[model samples]
Target: MSDSEETYKSIAVLGIGTVAAPLIEAGLLANNASVLVITRPSPKARQIPEGAHHAAIDYTDVSALTAAFRKHSVEVVVSTVNHEALDVQPAVAEAAKKAGVKLFVPSEYGLPSAGHTEGVLLVKSRFVDSLVAAGLPYARLYVGGFIEWIPYLFAINETGKFNIIGEGKAPATFTAISDIAGFLAYVLTHLPPSQLHNVSFRIQGERKTPRELAALYGDKAPLVEISEFPPSVKDGAFRKFLQVAFNAGFASTGYDAAEGKDDEKRAGSSNSLWPGHQWKTVKEVLNL
Candidate 1:
């Protein structure tokens, strides 16, 4: 790609839920990039942002998806589809490759998928393999858990009460949804494809245990431990395993003290990489 084609002037997004919403907002903020979303056909009318574009395509049909990407001249494909729609990622990757998309951003904003037994992680790993095999340029953002989801996952109730599944001292990596979205937008538009490809772009807002987080909330909220809630590996046991997994340090934890600074710098894929931005820690977010 030459200087004329090096920039990602147009982007295609795959979903429009919580994660995708902020991404789309960031895209619209970009000076030269045009945003387009591939939405599923709905019987009722659907709402879309004013400046951003939309295309209803059968994600099952790879050829149709390819045509849509080519028609829009989408340089980067940012997929923010939910876990339930993960099956369509390979097809999306294949279509992006066929359409000559410069970069493909897969929906992998969570824990590292290298050696996890969790079903969701396995699915993510497989999709990443497909991208590598297809020779597509891609960026994987391993943002651990979203801070916004903490309340719902920890069984927090409307009265500002919550429960920890086990001992409340397990530290987990968490990033605010807004920060993740902003970083994605920045990388897709500013970073060159050569640098963005095959990169594990990570950013975490806070790395704290549940007990620490509860303490930050102070008297306004109380935390309880529900020891009876056993971890399970059934179909929808992601949260259960997540609690135990973080407790066991299953996610990528930079390096040991003996490993030295080089490894620590590599492992600490953090917000410091991006300038002029303030990442919110638990204390900052909870007003502790």
Candidate 2:
């Protein structure tokens, strides 16, 4: 893996074990990018698109990760590894920065970080900051809540019931997994610059009310009424310090009311990234 050998066509994925499978498939589908899949002691592993490079190495070792980047001549680094896989994003970003990778996509395929109001996303905000400081072009794609999978995630199905915020009437957005990979690969191949691309998308699924969703589950779903607890606030000269303790916390009653004005302006995944390109709605996905 000499400096002279890199032709600049490779896209190195730091963790291929978790969600990289679909991303790699999508990247390879793009036809212009070469894939370099990296794993721990890189396994003989599962199937990926043909012509992609595979490496099983010690990612814990910064030098090992760097060497793989150089070996593949990767211009883009997709960080699909689990948070534990790369405990320190700054480290990976530093490696990507040094490797001169033109673009980096961190593992942020969940709900959009910016859209959250309850500070449910406080942890994610920190990671995005780290990516920005790394000094490479990054795209953070937000798929509003997962429409079909949250049941499994929250173990709602086990109880034959689910919990949601307020009257269950809020029209929150949700995105399909396949669509996420497609959108991400499309954006990565079309990297713009050092800025983080922020866009939220939802599947073309009908925005069914919670009752409607629960009804679909039949007797399994209780005739339950779910209510959203408004974002609580604390009144303090030191808002940050007092918030550390929930008992000391008192929500600013007016805050949630003020924020409520924009409740209806839901932003689904916009295919504007690829103008003239159409997206598949949930109906099409379910063959309805």
Candidate 1: tens digits of C-alpha lDDT, residues 126-240: 7877788888877888776778777666655443666666786756677788888887777777766667878777677777777877777666668867654434412225666
Candidate 2 at 61: error in angstroms?
1.9
Badly placed stretches (over 4 Å) of model 2 are: 1-9, 42-47, 83-86, 115-120, 153-156, 162-166, 190-209, 215-266, 275-288
- Model 1 clash pairs? none
RMSD (CA, Å), candidate 1 to true, equals 3.9
Off by over 4 Å in 1: 1-5, 158-160, 228-236, 251-268, 283-288
- The TM-score of candidate 2 is 0.69
Clashes of each: 0, 10
Cand. 1 Cα-lDDT: 0.72
Q: Assess each prediction's global lDDT (C-alpha) against the native.
A: 0.72, 0.53
Q: What is the lDDT of candidate 2?
A: 0.53
> For this target, which candidate reaches the highest lDDT against the unseen true structure?
1
